[model samples]
Target: MAALYVLLAMILVVLLSPLLTPFNTSTQFSDAIALPPSWVESGNMNYLFGTDDLGRDMLSRLLIGGLYSLGLPILMVAVSSLIGMSIGALAGIDRTIKYQSLSRLFDTLLSIPSFLMALIIIAILGTGFNNVAFAITLSLIPQFIFVTRNAVHEEWHKDYVTASRLNGCSKAYLLYRVILPNVTPTLVMQLTVSLSVAIMDIAALSFLGLGIQAPTPEWGSMLARSLDEVYLSPWSMVLPGITLFITIMAINIVGDSLRRALKERVNS
Candidate 1:
């Protein structure tokens, strides 16, 4: 199911790439600014989703915008998952207060509101794709650590873990060879869920002008820039918003399915 979700998203992005993204992402065709969806405007075949106040194609902007909105989250998720899973696996195998202490530090992080954390980070780092990713990664790492930590803790208690330890397996071998395999399913499920949140968070940051910036074709920033003219060109708002919704919804559906399957497998 997770595979299905990923496949669907990749296929959608690929199919939409040429038709959806801005023809010249950096160039501004001001003459076409604020045009309505082709269906709304007579004799205009271009701008299927309409144009922004700058006459930019809404559909094109949406397409390119999705690249950032989706791209950042996917990157963050991959980085965080690797780090988090490793940390968690080690903590579980070590079974020491140090791991608990490390986990506690992340718990303190979890106490702060995610948007507030991102805002604070942005305030220091300033707005850019890298800054936004850093801010979100900081906010999200704790979840990965916590989930991986707990999953590892449970795996450590399994019979095979004890058998591996007693069989004179090295610490590294026990973690990599024995524990890592057992925890992968849980880790993958967590990644799916975390990826969804990452997507939503970055979009929110872009909406606030603290992420991706203008003229680069990001959904949040596009929506932010378009909100003022929603009445004039509803597609300006609708197109980006719908894309964000669909992407998040698709991620969630996949995450939920993965979670259910993992739970069922564990039970069985």
Candidate 2:
């Protein structure tokens, strides 16, 4: 329950941050560069979180960066899940040559770690936002496909499925009316897996300088750029790191709680 509230608060803050930001994320304060958080002797009251090495306000940037860290992954998961569920479900329903080939290919791809897969794709596609987004989204799709395909395939062998087929139920009807409801929990569970991977992938790619570029207000890049300034201003690193930790933790707890609830409901 607490985790859910924290997640909601983070979402709300991310959504409303633009209006709440006190300074332009890019604006530099020449005189106020590298100050610590307010209350520190060297810190300025005007800059509550102080300024970064570039003199940009930390609080403003943190608020804005939450969007990229939290937002882009949501988009990535949506895209990957839609495409993956489609391909995976088709592969589950149709054991044809083409689908088999595609499924085998995904199996091979899944053997490679998602971050490594993203890196390999990025190597071919090059850096920058579009390429990184494409790379992460594509890397994540295989997991969805694998999970969804397995879930759907399991349903196909069930006694109920066989009975439905014997009753002359169409493939579409079986899929929508029978298979989907049974496998819905499994599919929804994969959502958390995809979301967690997406968040980590974006952060890692950005940290390595392959994801969202500088001045983009992304948590990962903020962490990367702030690394050297840690001694001078630890908040630069601590803020983003803590935020990432909290966000990921909240997601996992909520996802686990949801999975349990759905399983109980299905059993009941």
Candidate 3:
């Protein structure tokens, strides 16, 4: 619960950061280049977190960067979950040769490392916001597909499902109304975990220069930009790295709690 509250507070800060800070994330203050964190006596309170190599406020950049860093992954996860779940559910219902073949294809994709898969996809599609999201979605879809397919397959074999079928429930009705409901908790847990993976992937891609481009306030790009000045202003890199770490950790904690709660409910 404490983690949840902290996560919510972080999210609110990210959303309202622009309003909270007067510093322009893009504008560089020549006089404040490589400034240490404020409260160090030499640092200006105006740039509380300090300035980067280009004199951009680290706090302002981190807050604004988080908007893109967090937003894209959420969008990617939602899209992948929708498409993967639908396809997985359908394949789970139909054990036809074609569907089985599609399942095998997803398995093949899953065999590849996600980061490598993303890199391959970026190579083909080139780099951009949509492309990066699409790449991450592609990389993540297999997990959702595998989870949903297995869950639905299990639910389909249950006594309740058989009872429903005996009551003249149509295939579609059995899938949507019966199996889907039973599998939803598992799917929700999968989504939470996937969201965390998506966040990491987005940061990785951006760090590799395949994602959100320069001058943009993205956490990964910020980390990449700060590398040259690490010896001078380590906080620039540390701030974004810590932000990513905390956000991912908080999300994983929530995901774990959710999984436990769902498992308890199932046991009950």
Candidate 4:
């Protein structure tokens, strides 16, 4: 719980810091180019994390970049979960030939690595935040579909579901009123895990020049831009890398904790 609180605080900082900070993320101060972290006497305290090659404030960029890095994945997961849950629920309740075919189609999509699928989709859709989010959502939908389908299938056979059927409940009523509620905990857990993967995928695409474009403060693009300045100002690269690492780790910890809690409740 302490870890979760700390993680939430970090997320709030990332999401809100740009608005709170005075520095402009895009404005370049020529004097501050490639400066190391502010702790060094030569560096300016104004730029706490340091300045990039173009003299953009590292801290400011990170905070602004959070809007993209964090925002896109969250949107992607939500859209994916909605589509996945709908299809999965239908398949789980119906068990028809059409649903089975849809399951096989999801399996086929799953066989391809999500990053690879995103690349392929991006190749067709061109590049932008919306396109990237759509691509990531496409890649993620299959996992949610599988998870929700399996969870719903298991819940469908439970004693409560059987009792509901015996009471002359319609399939729609059972699905919406009973099965979905029972399977929701598992779905929530899957959503958390998927969010972490979505972040990594978004970053990878940006690193490959297929995601958010240059001059943007996205962590992946920041890393890409910092490569040439690695010897001169390594902190530029390290800061964004650390930011990404910590954010993902915190999300995973929270997700895992929730999963354990859910399991314990179920067992009890």
Best by TM-score: 2
lDDT of each: 0.76, 0.90, 0.87, 0.87
Q: Using TM-score as the measure, what is the rank order of every candidate, best first?
A: 2, 4, 3, 1
Kindly report which residue stretches of model 2 are placed more than 4 angstroms away from their true locations once superposed.
Answer: 39-41
Worst lDDT run of 10 residues, candidate 1, spans: 40-49
Model 1 misplaced regions, further than 4 Å: 1-7, 10-22, 41-43, 266-268
Extract clashing residue pairs from model 2.
none
lDDT of 4 at 30: 96
- TM-score-best of 1 and 3: 3
Which stretches in model 4 have alpha-carbon errors above 4 Å?
Answer: none
Clash count list over all predictions? 4, 0, 1, 0
For candidate 3, give the lDDT of residue 141: 92
Candidate 2 Cα lDDT to native: 0.90
lDDT of 3 by residue, 1-268 (tens): 8778878898888778779767888899999989999977788888889989888888888888878888778878888889888888988989999888898799789899877899899999999887888898899999888899999998888899999999999999999888876777788889888988888888998999998788888899888988988888889899899999999988888877877887778668
For candidate 2, lDDT tens digit of each residue in 1-268? 9999999999899999999999999999999889898978878899998889999999999999988888878888999999999899889989999998999899899899999999999999898888988999999889989988999899999999999999999988988899988787788778987788889999999999999999898999999999899998899999889999999999988888888888888779
Q: Model 1: per-residue lDDT, tens digit, 1-268?
A: 6657664875478457767564766655777767777776352576677667776666666666666788668888888777877776667667689887887888788788777888899999898878988988888887788888888788888898889889898988877777776666777778878888888888888887778877788888878887888788777788888877877777777766777776677667
What TM-score, computed on C-alpha atoms, does each candidate reach? 0.87, 0.95, 0.93, 0.94
Q: Which model scores highest in lDDT? A: 2
